[model samples]
Target: MDIDKIRNSAGSMKIADLKEGDQITGMVTVGEDLYMIANNSVHQIKLADSIDPKRIDPTVPNLQQKIFGKGSDSILVSRTMIFAHEICKGDVFEDSFNKEKIMNISIDLLRCVIDMDECFNIIKLYNKDAMSSVDDRRSVDLSMKLPSLGEKAINGETFFRKLSMSYLLILRTFWAAHNKEVDKIFDRTLDFVSKNYRDDERFIKFIQQLVEFSRMFKDWRNLIEHPKRGEYFKIIDYTYAGNNKISRPMFEVVSKKYPQEPVDLEVNMEKLIDLTISNYESLLCFLCERKLKEIAGYTFKVMEIPLKMRRYPHVRYGIALPTTKGPAPLG
Candidate 1:
């Protein structure tokens, strides 16, 4: 409730101090329970089972309230932390370096999602209320210009690129553990997977889907990073084509894979976000299934926060073993 926000040389901050676009560092284990540590202090993390709004102190900022209160898309944030924990199990990364790499990547991925989700929410909110004012329906210029594409903007194209880069980096690191030659480049990684992991049909299919998914955003991602002539994000403003229609604010990015077709930035971004999350879930399940015998005695537990207060990640999970004996079955 009265979570102290302390700034340190390492730039670590607690989950309570987490703003809409703030990035999480890494989580730590304090005894058997999990706590997110800042520079010198550890914040008590509320699992879904323990998250109660009524008990929330008024000292918590409104930003965190939106994130950790009700209807916050924070479950994904929690899932990312849990994902890192679970991913580190069962011989994925043999060394501490790779495991720490996984942790860093997962934390950054969580931040990317936090920024992306908030940007998407803003765009959706503006569009939903666009009809409220005539000017609202008019095209709005994002703060970013073509010359410097790196300037932070609360838009789909920017955050989408962020998410893609992080995902690809994680994929490379993840696969490299299995095959040391895998590179961070997406195409090269795909080539490696295609040739080496071809025996596994599910993995191959996933890689294929991932390739296609990456391609969907490839042109725009590249354009943002390395723009070519005549390639630009059509700002969510007036629909210049139709008969003077006030269009819903959205970005229009042409796919190099589908140059002739028109793509809705918002719609595609939503789909991409869902696909990204599912891909992670699939990867985790794939690994667990691959070692069923080793993990047979463990149970995956998801402690979910109430749906209303799920904005900031409240879910905590782990592969748990039964520690208490139940009554023997009566015969």
Candidate 2:
């Protein structure tokens, strides 16, 4: 799939003009009632019945899985956003913001993009083919809980899961850029980011959200990578809903030393995804400004685009151009 095209379409906020409302909704019929559920993340649902394996073709779920999760994998990684986490944990980015860090971050960024692109390619095919009827759509949604991803869906899921775990690699990659130690010590990294970019409000807020998210999914890195721990927390039923209002109580293990009653807390997956994109875009734009300042030998600010670009010729297509003299249709 085309990475640029997909990335451009991925961001819900960025693509506001392209589409108006949410594309997909997550829900299941329970005793003749439809209850909405979160788009992504593990959920705890009360199961009523069991399925007989011999009744249906297994391959059906495999094909359906793709359609349900058409653009979910578009939650592609942004180096700067993930790097913001590194900053919160330590003064790493600012301290050794060198060529090595830059190169490694660039590689990680490309990997995320490519990982998402692969998934989206499969998802894109599913969307184009499966949008004909309600039964088709129902199949797409139901297959979200299929035990096996099958061959076609497996590759996409593998890459998507890799992106989830890559946040750790992202931190480690930054650490390895300057340090020799291979030990995955998270505290030091957290320490570095907290110290360095403290003054930057946006940076602090961005990292705090991620830090909180990590707290919720504390063992996510290990859980996803280790085959045995893959189902450490059972996913009762998860529907790959679109960029809708998705929030679920993620089970957070409270330390026995300080046991708390509000152990179960909710997380907004949609907000987290939005923050990830925001952090990435914000940091990326900031870096762009820095680079421009360095190369131009003067402060060259990237001001807002012209009003005309936002209004007439840019947004409206196939219109006659207004030359220096007057509006005219060119041959």
Candidate 3:
């Protein structure tokens, strides 16, 4: 059960042969418990309790004094420290917990949203510029040379697609928000998920699948953002047969497991805003209602399940609405 063996093992391991300064490697459990495999000997160690302070004296200078810092029982273990230990022990790769990777993906998603917003703003500005130019013939020449409004509309559509993809990734990643209103909405969504789907393993697995999707989404985003010269714009249709992508699998698994849930998801900006408001209102009702238990229970059902079950598409291959060419395109 060496480090490689531990790394390859699918399940938990237990070994009792580890000694001080003898490096071990494996996945760290949620509670800081390390599961390691060294030379075919699998073991578990509670990291916080296993390390002897005296062992740190020579290897880590001034460690004991630092541990006793100003009334603290022990020095707090930073996430970086934990990750470093995991990597050094060969339990995790350097890229496993890279903040830059996560941030890059997140920023890529955010940029899509920002780009969409900018595209709309640009359209508005172009309209204003056009109107102003009509009154001033001096500037008419400049306006005539500008790109056609059709081009701008095409760019807007392209940006909207990018934004929709990024928004899906954001929902998948479960990123926290800097905006208070967004934070509230996120918290409410989590609460809804917990209340209605806690017992549903399929839903839980759906969330776990998002980690892989986030990576793919980032790759697709990079392709769109920095495409090679002469490369044509093509949407990666996850719904195509034999595609077997994360999003497709997610849809399949959830739809099969929860037949009542909606299969298609529409990205309506206004509806999302409304849903955020509704989430907050429901949360408030749950907290302040007179019949606390009854109200809270019913509110959870109404807020979480009804809309989801009604609007989500049942099949993965159905055409999305509000498409480029109306009903025919949607079909």
Candidate 1 lDDT over 1-331, as tens digits, reads 3332211113432356544654444455422334553332224454322333453444432221222221223456545645555444544222422444455556556666666677677666655654444442234653211111122234756676766765674465445345344544668767876887778977888877776666656665777677667666454553434554444545666544534245555676677676676676555445443433333454433232233433234332233333354211111
Query: What count of clashes does model 1 give?
Result: 12
lDDT of 3 at 296: 21
| lDDT of the candidates, in the order given | 0.50, 0.36, 0.33
Q: By lDDT, is 1 or 2 better?
A: 1
In candidate 2, what residue range of length 10 has the lowest lDDT sum?
Answer: 60-69
Candidate 3's displacement at residue 16, Å, is 53
After superposition, which runs of candidate 3 have C-alpha atoms over 4 Å from their true positions?
A: 1-105, 134-148, 175-331
TM-scores, each model vs. reference: 0.58, 0.39, 0.25
Winner on lDDT (1 vs 3): 1
Q: lDDT, candidate 3, residue 155?
A: 44
Window of ten residues with lowest summed lDDT in model 1: 143-152
Task: State the lDDT of candidate 2 residue by residue for 1-331, as single tens digits.
Answer: 4433332343322112112334433333323222222232111232211122332332221111121122221334222322222222212123433434443453455455455456545544543443321132345564322122235444333433544544544444434444434453466655665787666667556555544443434454344345242243222222233653222222222332222232211122323334444444444434433333232232233233233542211111111234554333211
Q: Which of the numbered candidates is closest to the native, going by highest TM-score?
A: 1
Point to the candidate with the largest lDDT: 1
